[model samples]
Target: MRDNEKDLSWWQTFKSVGAAFFGVQSSTNHKQDFNKGKPVQFILVGLVAVILFVMSLVLAVTFVMPA
Candidate 1:
């Protein structure tokens, strides 16, 4: 670990993953995430985010195009 780097909390990991989902993560944050973020944590959060995103889309479509 570098002198200024610290372990990322779950919230931080989620925010980082969210920013990545939007393709808007800053370079500084990206670097920090690589340095301090755990790969497993990121992967777990990313999976959950993807599931939620897909579910939201399904719900929106069902609502908009009723049977």
Candidate 2:
């Protein structure tokens, strides 16, 4: 590993994933993620986030629409 690269914690990974979802991740963080983050961890978190987002949209539509 490079001197600047270190393993990312779960919280850091989560935040990085969230930032990516919103397309607002900084270049520094992006580089860090690529350097230090695990691909499997990012994939799993992204999948979960997508599922939660879809579920929330479904729930909102269900509640907002007439029966």
Index of the highest-lDDT prediction:
1
Clashing pairs in model 2, backbone N/Cα/C closer than 3 A: none
Q: What does candidate 1 score in Cα RMSD to the true structure?
A: 1.4
Per-residue lDDT over 1-67 for candidate 1, one digit per residue giving the tens place of the 0 to 100 score: 8778679999999999999999999999999898899999999999999999999999999999959
State how far residue 10 of model 1 sits from its true place (Å): 0.4
Tens-digit lDDT string for candidate 2 (1-67): 6877678888898899999999999999998898898898898888999999999999999999999
- lDDT of candidates 1 onward, in order: 0.96, 0.91
**Poorly placed runs, candidate 2 (over 4 Å):** 3-5
**Native-vs-model 2 lDDT?**
0.91
Tell me the TM-score of each prediction against the true structure: 0.92, 0.90
